[model samples]
Target: MSSGPTGQPSLVRTGAKAGLAFAGSAIKGGLLGLILGGGVFFFYLGQLKGPGNTAARAGGAGAILALVTSPPLLVAVLLLLFVVVYAMLGVQRGRTKAMQHLVAARGEAVSERLAGAIAGRIEAMPRTHGTLQRAADWLSVDALSKQLAPVLGEGKAVRSVVGFVLNRLPMSDMLAEWQEGRAAHGAPVAAEGAAQDPALRALLTRRINETLQEMSTPSRKPLYIALGAHAVLLGVGLWLVN
Candidate 1:
């Protein structure tokens, strides 16, 4: 029922929520893997048939087309995809820890600053300790985003970091809003002398904002995925169609 000093359950932590996420991620990962693997298999099948064999030639073309558009490359693609999704979950999970830290840090930040405590808690919290680490990572992103929203508004640097995370950009239009707000208040870094130092917070916020903006634009990712998925399907379709 309670965790030991290690902060983990005496027993395994699996349950309905964990199970569902695992199943979902597994299904997703598997489907993607299958599509990728199948694409490769079909491509090879056609290649083995050689150019002399017209059917095989056409089939190979389909396979190559399929591979071209897919997300995970034929080599190391699965692990890579899993890791990307997993890291997302880690970031999300980190936020839950962030909230707990925030709550604890809130009381402390009033008297002191939370940067160290927040960072420490984040480091100490169990890193998605489960087979479904990837799923956990995915879930954590939402949690972190929600928890950090208010603090982000006040911390320009932190906000910029968030934005950069989202888009890998140094700055973005999102920062404009924060800048305007600061200008309106006439204190670009109000908490500069404070323990938390509002300016530093702003930097982090800015980076995070970048990441958020990038994520908001679903067109780039979904469209790319769609095109890649179809490329494989298209090639296969031709073979079957013929």
Candidate 2:
């Protein structure tokens, strides 16, 4: 069936070639996430039951360890971690893959045209929109995603394009920019020139580059997520082991 203005169905948009690429990237990242994540958790678990603690809980440790480290329990923990990490990276990989697919479908000229269109809209955002409003409408990942949907269609390419164009900065970053600039001065003076202020623009533009690099390099998001997830499992592992 046709889809959106592209007339290309979602399946066609992904294409077999792109799908395989996405899977390959996801699996590779998943394995990395698994190895790194598992290593950290294992290190912590060892520490928890390490030399000092192990001697103290020597008698109890064996029984608890048996239960916690059992084939079933170990598999479940690793499986959960793998799945979460896989999904996390999968979204990013899919976006990247979809964009490649989109480029294939539309060709470089059309792709650039689309890029120009989105950039034009963002650059044209009126100062009257207010700092927060402008940010909400044009300065956020989510907002860019929404904008990409209509022009880029509903494919994963939308997210990919958004990632390329904007960084997923925490609202606090912008809030800090706003607070330090405007609130501290005891005036919302920045509001009038927000969309056009060279300095503010430079700062946010710099932040955008920072975000883009994070998405491209992928930074440490997966590992960070892995750490947080394993922290919770650490408690459960201990509980079951005990």
Best by lDDT: 2
TM-score of each: 0.30, 0.37
Over 97-187, each residue of candidate 1 has an lDDT whose tens digit, in order, gives 3333322323222112223222222233343333122222232333444445443323332343333343353323433444566688785
Q: Per-residue lDDT of 175-232 in model 2, one digit per residue for the tens?
A: 4674577667676534332344444544555555454444434335555766676666
Number of clashes found in candidate 1 = 44
> How far does residue 51 in candidate 2 sit from its true spot (Å)?
33
> What C-alpha lDDT, on a 0 to 100 scale, does residue 28 get in candidate 1?
53
Candidate 2 lDDT for residue 19 = 72
Report how far residue 238 has shifted in candidate 2, in Å. Answer: 20
User: For model 1, what is the C-alpha lDDT against the true structure?
Assistant: 0.38
